[model samples]
Target: MHLVVRPLSTVKSSLFYSTSSHVPARAMVYAQYGKPSEVLSRMPLYRIHKHTLPDVKPQDVHIRFLAAPINPADCNQVEGVYPIKPPFNTSLGSDEPVAVGGNEGVAEVIALGDQVKGFSVGDKVVMAQAGRGTWRSHAALPASEVQLLPGFNSQVSLVHAATLTAHPHINVDNVEHHIGDYVIQNGANSAVGQFVIQIAHAWGLKTINVVRDRPNLDELKEYLTSLGATHILTEEELSKRETRSKLKGWLDGRKLRLALNCVGGKNATELGRYLDHEGKHVTYGAMSKQPMAVPAAPLIFKDVSYHGFWVSRWTDTHSRQEREAMFGDLINLIKEGKLREPVWEKVSWKLNASEQENETAFKEAVNKGITGFGKGKQIVFFED
Candidate 1:
């Protein structure tokens, strides 16, 4: 059979590993989808695999898992609610075809295929595509799916390592906006939200940040302000008519050209309320678990538009080099300390632990992720 995905570049793996050895991976996988608590059990999650890497394919890279985050979307996927699903095939070395559960993580390259290039042993890599199953202890993938983080000065936090794959922020210029155009977004405290702030700021874009009122509201506001946010407001304030007037007056006739909405329901409509003519509202997440409703006024009178973005679907259409280039820029920003990693709770996974123990900890992490906004992200790291 022919490979569906091709390597981004072709060259010899001489710069990488010399030994060809079998590499087994411990991964969390499920054959059928249902409520995560019910469908995601311990039986098959840790299983043997078919591609134990006795010999690496020409386009494959062997990777040792470092850290992987348990994202809410991942849990939703386990429940069979997420839109993009991983391919279930017998290749996972299971009794039947099953899909792995992780979407984002960091890894160390242990070996490379004969035709793989631009990577060496011990090099760090971040997931370049969603549904690549980073939950495993090891993985062998096509070079196109992983972006290399240089072994040199470009160091990143373990949290950043797992999250660099979550939302592949499109090149700002690729959006329907010009430089210095005003963009507004709610959930500015989210991993993706923080990234939007730094990315927009670094690329000469201005962002108006919005957040739900929290106990540490002042501190969170201060933190976002330091990241080059031009304006920040709470959800309560944004819902007010007077606040919109104030926002318009403060901008001095500059149109609020784009609104990034991660929280849906009324928050989404409110996000579209203050826009320049024909503004675009791109919704990437629905943390509120609410449906988006748009007022007819903006649609008929102002030509405001609503669209959805999912990073997993994006990888199917976009070039690997483009995704890697975006990753490179983000990595550079993190290395300089300009972009800060979000708060996260680290979960240690050990092979010696009873399967029941692993299941309980993972279940806890999943629940935390579902509820863990502003508090922190749930990250799983292996203990040596």
Candidate 2:
């Protein structure tokens, strides 16, 4: 199927054809960090007022955003808790704060600079940079910072591209394993965890997922299993002697070589206990906001290794070709229906009517992970 291709100039012109009717687009902007209420306030949106697109350097490509996700890091960035911050550009005509919020999203290439290669106007892509002005309608980013997406079903395109921003270092091809080799992950129901489950399954790896029990435990397990998860266990289940005995039998005495941990407190420690000798545990997030503590036995006896992973940092260190290859593998998995986007609740991005509603929904979703407000991430949809 042929895809619709439009230049950045064309999109801008069509939107701002008449000056009198033009309205600034809404975005989540912040200046200082504090509580979520203090940092993220609904402010007047910005748009391309005139024909001048941001001057694209030889190494840059212009993109019209299709969708962007509000990740925990995005929220933390708004609260000034994150280390990487987007440079505040005053030239965008915003007097207040001069920052836009967002980390992950899918975009369509609208324009490419003279020095660019292997990209075209219609390619679907995701940003390599984690936190930037992705919440806005358009972005002019370095060519090397964009990872092209393989042709994907439009319904799953946004989730596939958005969730990939967190684990830029994980390459499905680099993983050496076959069906039934154990892949373990804590926070198994998280957006990233769900992706890990799907990708691991697609690669023929068996996953042992860990989650905190919710009211709908059975439903959640069913959801994870539907995504190809082999085993789903709550923290309570893992703590049970019987369950551990069953797990040992399930592995047929084979040790778990890989463990992905997002939660860093006792949960991480628990996951570490299941690791095989010389195994690797990759910690990408601290959802609990607690320091990770490991029992000395695992380090001394098992010779296990713990590594911290921040996808943004990894992407900064890797070549664009490497990043694109990882994304391509993920896209192919999605196309084959082996990978599915995590269950998400949608929020409308319409400013005039839905601004208040969106804020309430976002706040509720953010609190849900901690306070049990709801299940799953809240996705904001901006329509043309």
- Summing lDDT over every window of 10 consecutive residues in candidate 1, give the lowest-scoring window: 1-10
Residue 62 of candidate 2: its Cα lDDT? 70
Off by over 4 Å in 1: 1-14, 40-53, 150-154, 170-180, 352-354
- The Cα error of candidate 1 at residue 170, in Å, is 4.3
**Model 2 CA lDDT for position 48:** 18
Q: Please, what is the TM-score per model? A: 0.87, 0.82
Per-residue lDDT tens digits of candidate 2, residues 96-185?
Answer: 546777788887776666567767776778876776667665666677778776555564668666666665535242345656789888
lDDT by residue for model 1 (211-295), tens: 9998998898888888888889988889998997788766776667788989998988888888878888888888788998878
Which predicted model would earn the best lDDT?
Answer: 1
- Evaluated with TM-score, which candidate comes out highest? 1
Local distance difference test, each candidate: 0.75, 0.68
Clashing pairs in 2: none
* Counted clashes in each candidate structure: 2, 0
Error of 1 at 339 (Å): 0.9
